[model samples]
Target: MTSTATTVPAAPGAPAATAASAATGASVAPSARPAPVPLADLVDAGLEVPVLGGRTVRHVNLDLAASAPALTAVAAHVGAVLPYYASVHRGTGYASQASTALLEDARVAVAGRVGARLDDLVVFTRNTTDALNLLASAVPGETVVLDIEHHANLLPWQRRGRRVVVAGPTFGATLDALAAELARRPAALLSVTGASNLTGEVLPLAELADLAHAHGARLAVDAAQLLPHRPVDLAASGIDYLAFSGHKAYAPFGAGALVGRADWLDAAPPHLAGGGAVESVTVDAAEWKTGPERHEAGTPNLIGAVALARALAELERIGEDARRAHEDALAARLHDGLAAQPGVRVLRGFDDLEDRLGIATLELERGSVGLVAAALAAEHGISVRAGRFCAHPFFDRLATRANGLRVSLGAGSSADDVDRFLDALAGLIADGPAFAYDRTPAGWCPRTDDRPRPSFA
Candidate 1:
């Protein structure tokens, strides 16, 4: 099945066509234009790993929601930048000046990629958790959030005044519940996830933004799962703030950003009180710098910022339509295949959710999920996630057992990857693992195994 949607225009300052066309004075006709390059071809597509029974096979990464392998383009860009890497903002050397320029360019790219408004500030952060924590500190009034959020979006708000509304039976009812909460008591912000990490269901941001605005609140979205699969236009959608991680976007260099309005951020005290965050300091007092400088203390992740920017650019070049088509086909296959298995039960948050990414979490009727996850890895070279996935409250409410198995795909995933996982799972469910397994300190492992670790490790 194909996932269909209106083609979203490229954000301001983002590439609208292939890099080759941008370089030369040429225009390619729509009919003659080549298909976007396969995402699998742009990453570590040929990775091989050792499995049980003295065999090695191609590694199938089905755990993209946790962390994705760095795209080859991003890695190449990082390699080119490392030689001249230096501390930014104050050094007089050529390398420092160049590094400073690159960092600022990355900031601009991030802002443009999200369609940030003119007054919005793009603050570099450690990851989504750190970005939300920074926003939590700056928010002036009580925040309203749904109970289905990831812990990163939930925990930070809890530290401040927060109102948690239980999601209703259907997506539409959930929106009504949120509207009711905001009407009952005014909130400064309405925080929510763009896509669910476990169920892969997508939330309608434009509608959510309108709901928040009607209730006199601002909307903030956690787009770690959404950005990889879809394009986000904060300005057009009326989102006041956005947060996402590079690691989840196929740029795993330990970087993230918070893009949003600047008033509250400037009013709040600096997130960290250090050198770069201060404008003037004395023995008795210190004055903090406003904007992004107020929060980015000490040295920043220069390489990470550059890598993230490159990844976003590459995604733009690939185009959203191509990415969606590839992922939609794979997701449909995985979901349908899992549903066909008698022992497997697919999880869902709402009955009315129509759009979702390539993620699925399921429970088995008669096996330890941990053992099955381990068996897939040891015997089939397939990697997946098992456990609470860092959203314990939501997991506890939805799952039948302590945890469930999650299979997620991304830009680098192919149809074969999904098929392999489904086949292995079916075999395991029907006849159990081919090898004896035992619960170890780390989780489950083969009773007698001697698979060699990769030489690099």
Candidate 2:
């Protein structure tokens, strides 16, 4: 359940970390090597942040699960489309028509990316939390969810009288527990995450879907973490509802989607009661529209949708195989390196690295998690997430300490990035922080703020 990487190098044949060989004694050609990812073309392509002693370094972002850098292709697409943008749905102008077409096309693209059924409805919301909250409102009866889920999936259901099933020791047992709960009662929904935000543990979504369906419950997947790292097929998995965010999917913030069967969504009231949701608004009566328009009451995030579509397309162009190769290599390196480190604990229930995303959370012995994170940023320019990572219950379950450090990999992350973090952690463990830091009410920060301030002007 716990391991450490003493050195930075990964162990040989780490599960899901090695590329498949052709056959016995077959050699791979040099041309077959995966090309380096081209995600550096991000808007802040060469941006650097200040570290300790007034020095600056190019940020090594290892927080992909939280939010990813916008792809260059996506930024370019947004720039090209911005000039001709106008109001969607009702505008009669050329720009409006083009914008409307773009939004519809984006909806199709997102739906296609997740393998949504032909009859499924894709409703755009603020983010995954908003999308899940919308679904929570639509459920007619009690919902069943696990305590290991992120707050986005948990809190919404709690408001709707959800049954919280504490996860068992093993993943199989957890599924069995869910089955037992569903069998015990008639639940309206079975809410779960495609992957754990805290541990990156990929849940058994297919079997879960089968169980939910058999118990007459609809399965809703919060794919904010899974969609970025792995492919999710709603149709194939038999998931009735799915929600994800554009920020985690490599697009700009402020847009997310809830894709699922139309019946529940249609029967529920409009998510918003503004302009576009209504078909007619008389003095005493108001009728609502159906489909996505019902929830997207005001002007929708056309730019966000277009950006998301472009990011998804870029990922598709690069191909999942290549991305997975890159992630596997980096994750293996990070995982093994951290596991080998003395006094470091890798947070997860699984002993192998096969059933995880490119995410690693660690509980350190030498220093506080917040201090370690700050030291990494201030001293070594490595940016990783620290603290609870928005999943209090799961973090409480995994971490023996109050806080933990999280490093998540993505297509943009390089092996060099992983090595830098490992080296930084080793240094911190050996020498402590180079710069003086103080824990503030907000969080830990460098005590010395003598560096020149960045000017927006």
Give the alpha-carbon lDDT of every model.
0.85, 0.80
| Shift of residue 321 alpha carbon in model 2, Å | 1.4
Cα lDDT tens digits, model 2, 185-302, are 8898999989888888888789989999999999999999998777888999999999999899888747889999999899898998899999899989899988888889999999
Error of 1 at 185 (Å): 0.9
For model 2, what is the error of residue 377's alpha carbon versus the real structure, in angstroms, after optimal superposition? 1.0
TM-score of candidate 1 relative to the true fold: 0.91
Predicted candidate 1 versus true structure: per-residue lDDT over 298-349, tens digit per residue: 8999998998888888888889988888788778778776755555778899
The residue pairs in collision within model 1 are none
lDDT of 2 at 206: 90
Which stretches of candidate 1 lie above 4 Å from their native place? 1-42
Cα deviation at 168, candidate 2, in Å, is 1.4
- Taking all chains together, each candidate's TM-score versus the true structure is 0.91, 0.90
Scored by TM-score, the top model is 1
